[model samples]
Target: MRNHTAINTFILLGLTDDPQLQILTFVFLFIAYLLSITGNMTIILLIFVDSHLKTAMYYFLQNFSFLEISYTSSCIPRYLYSLSTGDRTITYSACLSQLYFIYVFAITQFFLLTVMSYDRYVAICKPLHYVTIMNRRVCRRLVIGCWMVTLLLMLPLFILLLGLEFCNSNAIDHFGCDAHPLMKISCSDTWLLQQMVVICSVLIFILTLVCVVLSYVYIIRTILRFPSAQQRKKAFSTCSSHMIVLSISYGSCIFIYIKPSAKDDVATNKGIILLNTSICPMLNPFIYSLRNKQVKQAFTDLVTKLYSSQGTREILK
Candidate 1:
């Protein structure tokens, strides 16, 4: 549909065009989205209720959870509706909005993960100064700075996208409206937009990854200085989960943006996006919360407190 005509609506050719497959896809995505929502909310609630969990680490974790909930919600619900109802048409404004917020939140993920790495670095490499360095005011400023930076990074790209004319081809080959797919269908030359995306990707992904690597190097050195093997294992354990989460998140993102052409294989692109948007968010809660001993203890304590309260109320009655 690309011959110099403005497109009002786009049909998302989503993961599949098959009716049976659409039902299965809807079910799968629905369940995944539900789990992601539940898990992330649990993390946020646990951190908020448990004073012991209130630290720079959990503060970042709460922010990450909120971002994941917003990030996945941006696309999954629309995709599910399209699959279930067989109505894949999305308005131009709606598509652009989704694209905008997805990029916004995705960029925030990079920033937050970088911040988490720095927090770990301080906690492990400079334990004596950790509290002083990562104070409440500092953490708040860092998070606000992340969102501000993301807004600056995305505004130019949004303007560039606005200038492009979407002619006849209105069918997006993937599950949602991404920059690459939109560029492919645009009648205008996408060189500038492509360049902007590449530049920003490098700035966000590569730079943050370098920071995380450097932080870990210092962390490892500090851990090794500890005399006891048990101490070393305990120190590493604190960071191991975060590192795993970072790998999965960054690995998927790198594959998506580092490629010469993301739209070359529509099937592969959609599958990779599913992993990034759906699967990865779902994994974050488990990776950080379930595995952390403090979180488990907090959950147990909360449960016990609630139970005792209920028992007391029954006795009073």
Candidate 2:
């Protein structure tokens, strides 16, 4: 009896077959890993130290920065290790765990973005109710809810993948563990679970998309009604950052899931997933941190204090 798709583990092909390319890929990913970790960590450290950043917005942002770092670390570093060593094997349990965490981070991030957008809407569109609506209690609960919902939604992918028996092929084409790409290799009919994936994807997408759109819609309307040029500029500046992130984030997700099938464009689909995982996390800190006056000031003051203290230590020495 031949094993058709009974793969206990998978050999991740990584980026390229060429030896030179493997080295290049490793170098590039290693640098990416470093920058992503360093950049996200700096935000977390600054947010932690600066009392100025203790507000609801930065709190959500802190969670986001942490998630970004985790998301990339889960996929890229493991892929880098496999590519560099040429031993592409991933244990069955490892692959499942990877899949679960990927969804946890990704789905949670989307919901978190949605929550952030709603927070902005309250702050901008309804200033009177801003504090009342987005109180510390509410924000904390909502953030926690995002994490919970993402974990619950991601369970189905594991359930489906686990039940299926792989006959022979155990190679995952991409650099890391991906649910869809890995599913494509199974001998069993995955159509039953495609609906689950679609439903989860749509629920996540629709909720986030709707909230983001409605927030912006009101935000735009409110900005238009304002007579002061300063107010208009402030509104536009604040909203634009959220808009940029929402567009890119949802666009990648919807583009990938809405496709007729995941098998249609394995490389391109993985590329888009990579984009969502790679660029979005790094972009959040830059977009959210730099644009807001409070975060910027906190960042500046923290750096200034650190350097100033260092100088004082040298003088004292």
Using TM-score, give the best candidate's number: 1
* lDDT, each prediction: 0.89, 0.79
Cα shift from native, residue 60, model 1 (Å): 0.5
The sequence of per-residue lDDT tens digits that candidate 2 reaches over residues 1-317 is 33423456778876568898778767766776777788789889888999877777778878888988989888887887787667899987888788778878888888999898888888888988877888889889999999888777777767787776677578778877776766777777889787787787788788778888887788788889999999999878877777787888887777877766545576677667766777677677777677778778887898899999999999999
- Please report, as a residue range, the 10-residue window in candidate 1 with the lowest summed lDDT: 257-266
lDDT of 1 by residue, 1-317 (tens): 34433677898988877788878877888889999999999899999999999899999999999999999999999988888788889998899999999999989989999999999999998899999999999999999999999999899999998887887588888889898889988889899899889898888888899999999999999999999999999999999889999889888876766775544566886888987899888989988877799998888898899999999999999
Could you tally the backbone clashes for each prediction?
3, 9
Clashing pairs in 2: 3-167, 4-168, 5-166, 5-167, 5-168, 6-166, 6-167, 6-168, 7-166
Q: Top model by lDDT, which number?
A: 1
| lDDT score, candidate 1, position 117 | 96
Error of 1 at 42 (Å): 0.6
